[model samples]
Target: MELVEKIKKSSVTAFISRIPKLHLAAVAGLGAILLSTQLLSNNKTPERQRTTISLPVTVSSPSIAPTIAESAPQTNSAAQWRTEKLKIRNGDTLSSLFKRAGLNDRKMMNFLAATDDKASFNKLLPGKTLEFSLNKEGDIEQLSYVLSKLERYTFSKDNERYSLEKELREPDIRIAARTGIINSSLYLAGTDAGMDDKLIMELAEIYGWDIDFALDIRKGDSFRILYEEHFLDGEKLRNGPILSAEFINQGQVFSAVRYVHTDGRSQYYTPEGKSMQKAFLRAPVDFRRISSNFNPRRLHPVTKTVKPHRGIDYAAKTGTPVWSSGDGKVIKSGYSKYNGNYVVIQHGGGVQTKYLHLHKRKVKTGQRVRQKQVIGTVGATGRVTGPHLHYEFLLNGAHRNPRTIVQKLPKAESISTKIIDDFHRQTQPLVVQLEAETATLLALNSKGSQNKAL
Candidate 1:
């Protein structure tokens, strides 16, 4: 109380001495301005005063149990998209093909077995193709197929198993050829005929040196061939082997009998006992400069340094197939970082041969092979200058030219007296059958010609 009185007395004396010049408005205005400034400062948001806080935050993380509320089931792609084709082979049944293709729909099984026999029997044979579709998960979404004989069938699969549906579709036929000229390439001619390159090359291999397709085809040559042209309903699928063919080159005539022997071995033989297969094959390499000619000088293609090449190099196209020069056994087939892909054959009597720089090795070890059989394809494997076949022939551990060894094959021994008699007895009936069939075809053809003439 005494301090307040003293501050009041002092204020009154200071006011009297200054002659009291303060206006009431000025004092009230000053007090009001001070109050307003304090109110504004208090209302304004404070500057974000970040201090270096070193307090450890006891972060309480929420309970994060992985959620599993009705997740979608995983669908398998193997079940979704179909395998596209089922090869109908001898003794193949609907059930078996489906099973082999990994289809497990029981309803489809029962349906295929039940109804279709009366409408169209479900018999499978070689050279036939069937098609099917699958859902996104690779399950049998639908079943459909076309037979080579122009028959068709379809099926459907839902969550329900399978149901049969009959269908009729027109087949598309495409005529193609695989030809080999004695001097010109059959592969080239086949290309002109709109055949697949692979098929045409295969045909040359099937005929091989026997016909000399590259060297034998002449100008104005004529040939007529019959073969299975595959179709998938309205679309053509694949080309099959030549069933029959007639060739006329430079006034010489040739025909092949595609005889599937009862023993399941099929071979192309001349009308006589002579085999179309030669003892040694004609050299597949055509006139490439024989570099280093069976030499002991070793050179590497990459390093371009001295390295022994066991085989002779003959430059050719990549993917050109290499054939065994004679009947032999596959002793080795594999890839080497140095050798590339290679094949070694152990012919009888210690006559071994090796082929290197292959794009692919078709045969494996211990596989018995016939003359001119394809062992591998040519390529620039390992260290090579472009694509070529490196072929080596060794007789009793000595290198020999394949050309030297393969002029003609040595003839087989003559049949024994008893064996000849037995062979004659057995072959006589077959010869008669063959003769009759040949005569019938000729007669029919002659009659048709005469009719055309008339």
Candidate 2:
């Protein structure tokens, strides 16, 4: 038996020695797997004590797998409505603008249909801007159109329905003062002192009853005015009416203040509550000059003989407008051999005005004419030396000098006693402001003159 055992052992040893190194490794791996299975199957072994097994490693580049963060859905927080501003160009309509903005025609039609009577969007002007707010679905949320600095229109969507709103902005009004000295012409001096044409015209009209702007404005004449200026959002928009004005013409001072009564009637009055306007304007026409004054024994320009001149002559360009000196009714508007085209208006208190040598008569017989209304235009159609207006003023069917007769006519009505106090209260501050501004300007001018002389 001992011999047999020795032989068997020797045979096994030989078999084991003949196995290759790779086969030995394979067998060891199988044994390790079996040992791990046995350990995991044991109920006594704790789950925490278990270790993961590793397989044979291949030394190739690893491919990256997409993680949960990369594969998840993305969100855009900035995806919302946006606004676009479009200016109206010539020939651009609301429909065309909407089309260019990628908005549908149906919405525009709906918007127009809703705001048809409430607004006038069809009349779009150049340089006007239209702002539109659109949603993510390209639908208009709000639309705004600015008509002017004071007017605006807006259409907004509320609960799928559009409504139109018209907004009117009232400008803030403030008082402004200006002073001017006439050097050559009122227009030039007024404009040089920061006064516009409209203001200058207004100033002339306020004093039109006494002064003829065409012939009466003289050098060294100065004026002070207090008026209103309108502002919007801290920017100047335009000028308003004059509150008070003081004019010094030919060394004569005239002060006037505008007053509005409780009955809505407004007029200008002096500090003593006397009316600044007269019953008649001194001149019937804004003539360049008096070609012939009221001279009874003057030599006739056409007849070349000593004759009694019945009226004054105003030299002006042909077609120069002739105004009625006062309110009256025309008694005759006819043509004559000696008067060419003429108009005769009879005023209150047996007063009559005759306008002769007219290019054309604008009023007919029996027509009621207001003061300063154009009745005819100057012409040289009659027996005259040049294009001039022959104006005659008659009192009680007798001829009188038109320029001198107007000064003797009835004065304008004064402010009533009931409203005189109110007038003074409102106009006193304006007058004071005007006087202060004028004094300051005069001081500055004097200082400037002295500096120049030095």
Cα RMSD of all models vs. native, in order, equals 23.8, 14.4
Collision count of model 2: 0
lDDT of 1 by residue, 182-234 (tens): 33545556666456766555455544544444344566665444455768656
Candidate 2, residues 13-119: lDDT per residue as tens digits? 99988997777787799788879788778757555455566655548988999999799765742246688888889999888888877777897887666554434
What is the RMSD, in Å, between candidate 2 and the native fold over all Cα?
Answer: 14.4
TM-scores for the candidates: 0.44, 0.64
Candidate 1, 437: how far from true, in Å? Answer: 18
Off by more than 4 A, model 2: 1-167, 183-185, 214-218, 448-454
- Look at candidate 2 and tell me the lDDT of residue 138: 76
**TM-score of candidate 1 to 2 decimals:** 0.44
Worst window of 10 by summed lDDT in candidate 2? 113-122
Point out where model 1 deviates above 4 Å. Answer: 1-184, 190-203, 211-255, 260-266, 283-327, 333-338, 359-377, 410-454
